[model samples]
Target chain A: MNTETIQSAIHPNQNHPNRNRPPLCFVRHAVWPPPRWGIALETPPGVGMKNWSNEFIGVDWGTTNLRAYRIGCDGGIQESFEDVLGVSAVSDGNFAGIVRELRETLGNLPMLLSGMIGSSIGWRTTPYVAAPASLEDIAAKITWVEPRWTGLLPGISVLTNSRADVMRGEEVQLLGYQSEHGLTQYTICHPGTHTKWAKVRGGKVEDFRSVMTGEQFSLLKEHSLLKAMMHGRVEPDRSFLEAVETGWSGVELTAELFTVRANVLLSRLPECRAASTVSGLLIGMDLRTGLRLAGHDLIVVLGDPALVRLYTAAIEHIGKDCEPAEGATAFVAGMTRIKEMIQ
Target chain B: MNTETIQSAIHPNQNHPNRNRPPLCFVRHAVWPPPRWGIALETPPGVGMKNWSNEFIGVDWGTTNLRAYRIGCDGGIQESFEDVLGVSAVSDGNFAGIVRELRETLGNLPMLLSGMIGSSIGWRTTPYVAAPASLEDIAAKITWVEPRWTGLLPGISVLTNSRADVMRGEEVQLLGYQSEHGLTQYTICHPGTHTKWAKVRGGKVEDFRSVMTGEQFSLLKEHSLLKAMMHGRVEPDRSFLEAVETGWSGVELTAELFTVRANVLLSRLPECRAASTVSGLLIGMDLRTGLRLAGHDLIVVLGDPALVRLYTAAIEHIGKDCEPAEGATAFVAGMTRIKEMIQ
Candidate 1:
């Protein structure tokens, strides 16, 4: 199928740049890293590929959403699909049924799943590789469910005397960013519901920490008394920056959070500014810890563009240098690197 | 008609000290302050007093609960009634109906309502008296919804260049504690859903701050991803104390909070310890701020016995001096003091 077909199915409203591009056409033995498995020449040409050995489906199955990428032999995304069928939605443990459906849509290529799909609640219980872990270390520990049908990427865990932290799907993005940039030492920040900050050294993830800033922000907006005052869109406005300054100044978070409501009540903060104020306060605190952990390493932030913009702004506001990257792109690159290592 | 009747109406399960005590007998002019209004001396003596002018109903109407105290002329609680009908429960703004019912049970005494009842959503939208507020300041700002039937105590607001904080019913408790102890300078911590820490100097609330520790703990327990691992009772156990120490050490709360889930996933922490661990972390962070604000002054914690126990333990664990006081007693004392000012 063409790019429009895939983009439309995933994001129906957004206009795509490659919207009307011709369907992908493949030639025999197109790129390097020759097919490892037996090649079938009888399958259709462009609609479906014959050599499934050189092609793989990378599924980033997280708690709330699933993103699948069809990687060609050239280490590029030929097509993609997105759905909200995450692990939490598989309440009946029918992960097999979901995988079967994915095969029907993305072709019967060997699938590699990451994220919470590797946890106990996912299709199969996969173990966590301890830090400092590398792309090779993670690929070596892949747990195959149906041998050729599905394989689950192991998550990464860091346990210390002071704290313990773990991540599943974000590891791929982190590794992808590291491999793509060819960086031997740098801090990678993947912001999401659980924002992860990982330190890389000697091409391995030495250690990391997770901050629940995004999730807590959602919780406060949806459930807390602060919900009443948190109206309007959360943009990086003056109020947001001011709140970020306050947060970065080392004020207590829980106490400062109360000021969101207090400011509204005292007529110091308007309702429209409340949401951004809350966002800035949380991000500022998250950055406070993140900067301390990063310590002299350049922070590479990868996530949704809106979140990236806010984080980048906060980082700069604190007079720190931060580079923005695309999380989806990193995931694809990481998956491509791992696919090459498999068998 | 007796203590048991009132105690059972309020707390049906807890044993009361004065249970089954004989009905109260009143002698005229027994207290220092004489009656201010008309003296009927016509109604039933012990069951319902004839003169409501010397007596008043003190109602602490909050967000989630309503507590009514039939305060006698001797500055004592003759009878009390409590229900889950807080301001939030009055969705249709039928606060008058609730007050009418409270009057029917507690007597036709003019009522003085404190807490969220003075908030925007309560019976009347009462203005907040600006700090530093004294009992006299709050008494003078009482908003009369119905001059003869109901009066709403003004909440307190502290506005500065850096931050702003407001409290509804807590001002009563703070002032009550100050007046009861006859202290000129001290710090008071009233811990609850929104824990309020106020500095009482010269018998006035100099300034105050609020931390949403209890509310955030409840939110994390009920709504966040951490909810899955948070099971069993949350006591001040070893896990709780350890988490508290970490929190008190000034770790970034959001980052450290994620350890609740991470520790569970890595098998480092058991499921039973999750609840207490989360509590200790939040409390520890709260105490870190509370202690900083309290400085060298003794912190008097007043609230529910269970919450007081936790705060007391956390405070002492940090090697700081803290005294536990009864919140209901403070509320009653403050109400009595305010009632006496209504000439």
Candidate 2:
């Protein structure tokens, strides 16, 4: 049993005994065989050992879908595919079989999976690592399942004033950002159905907060009194800007929400504008709390382009700075960094 | 050209010059035929004028239904009936015909309608009476619709810091409480889909605030993530009390809401208990904001028994006093007072 931790891929000074070994790969974004870090296989799987090359795979298995990336030995993506059978949908308990098929097709690569795959509903429930956790802390806690070919990453949990908060998958992305920019403090925001604002200090997640802004926005737009008033696309309009300012003013969100409907009924505020206004208010409120915690540090937003744009605009509106990163790209980069740590 | 308001059936000191004259009746929740105010009926229209005693009818015509209260000349509810055809349902513009049929069945009675029946979607759009408005102010603004059979009571509108707030049916109920108590200062809380807290001073609603507690609770329980955790009866339990206290602590609601789901997942909070906790949190938050604006005074809660109980429990939880009043009874009393003033 020769097991050793792989040292920092970014910093050669922070040495580990296994640092000189060829690193394991977890790929994303990059095209297949991108010469820089890609090794082309000279033979097919089960071929003669002289020509075969062992690879690594990264899986972002979330509540809605499972995305698998096959990385060449040199850390570049060779191919990628996705299965719609997310953790929530895999009811037949055939997770091993599903992974087996993929592994066979991709030459039996060693795999690391992140996101809801480790949730209670996933293949195995991996206990969360309490915050003030570094990438090494997370990588050490990875649950090596019964299947020797797979490793599952644990989610991060933070206890703020006795209120428990947890996030899966995003923790990996945060580590990726940290690996790319070493041992520095930054506010990493991953916005989606449940948006998280995490503080990274000295390459560890100090603490974070989760706001139900995205979920509430969806519920209100689809099932609330404001639903009928939401006519056009939920883009940031003039009303959206005004609402953002209103939210930033420390107003109670519940109280202010009633006024949205009242304004539509009494002031004849256009329905389309009302929808945008709601989005602005929710996003603005999240930012208000998030930015306060973030302080005057670099704020990096990772999410869909449309959502990221909204947050960026709101951030600048309040005289703050923000950088946008694609969520999928960050997920892959984060997975790659973690793979290097366990290699 | 012969137009006159109905004479007071309750006020003894306030003399109407038309007291001796035959008083035309426009009834609502109020009972009539009191010995002091009752007048002998004149000859009835058409065939034999002998046994036909024209009654006053009080119609609580709201958004969902039409509640007609037929009263004797003296001050008493003779009989009451409800029609499911609400303001929204009367799309054929047969409001007059509807009222006419009811009037004929009850002996050609004059009707006083209140609630959403006077809104833009109602039979006639009655303008709202601005707040800090007395019963007299509201009475003066009542619109006499084209249908000779009905008088629509105007809803009250309040502008708080330039935010427009309006209440149709609840205002009448608040006045009913005021008329019964004779214009003392009190905080009147009417709980429903949209809960209202009004500041009443000397027979007038000075100002008020509307909180959408009930509707939000419904949306969260049925449509949001908490829906799964919201099993069992939603009645107040120990969890409800605890949640109410949590809500009254002035925590940001949006942030706290996420915990309702997280607690069930992490802490194993009972699914049934989660429902009551959510209710308590919502009600408690409303009371916190509502009571602060209501000031230190007698709090009158007027609504359904179940809802009123929740509000009463929450109000008392904070060491405050709350008096529960049935909504229907108050509306009748309020209408009686308004009828007296107009007369």
Q: Pick the candidate with the highest DockQ.
A: 1
Per-residue C-alpha lDDT of model 1 across residues A99-161, encoded as one tens digit per residue: 765554565677889999999888888999999999899999999886645789999999989
Runs with alpha carbons beyond 4 Å of true place in candidate 2: A1-57, A64-111, A121-124, A141-146, A150-152, B1-54, B59-109, B120-125, B143-146, B232-238, B339-343
For each model in turn, which proportion of the native inter-chain contacts is also found? 0.91, 0.50
What is the CAPRI rating of model 1's predicted complex?
Answer: medium
Q: Which residue window of length 10 is worst by lDDT in model 1 chain B?
A: B25-34
Per-residue C-alpha lDDT of model 2 across residues A1-343, encoded as one tens digit per residue: 0111111311123333333544433333544323322323333233232221445778888876667777655656676655445666556656776676555444456788889999877889998898998878888998987443478999988765567778888888777777666648899888877788999998889988888888888888888767878776776667787888888876666667887777776764676688888888888888876897799889999876899888888888888988988776566667777777666
Model 1 chain A worst lDDT run, 10 consecutive residues: A25-34
CA error at residue B237 for candidate 1, angstroms: 1.8
- lDDT (0-100) at residue A121 of candidate 2? 78
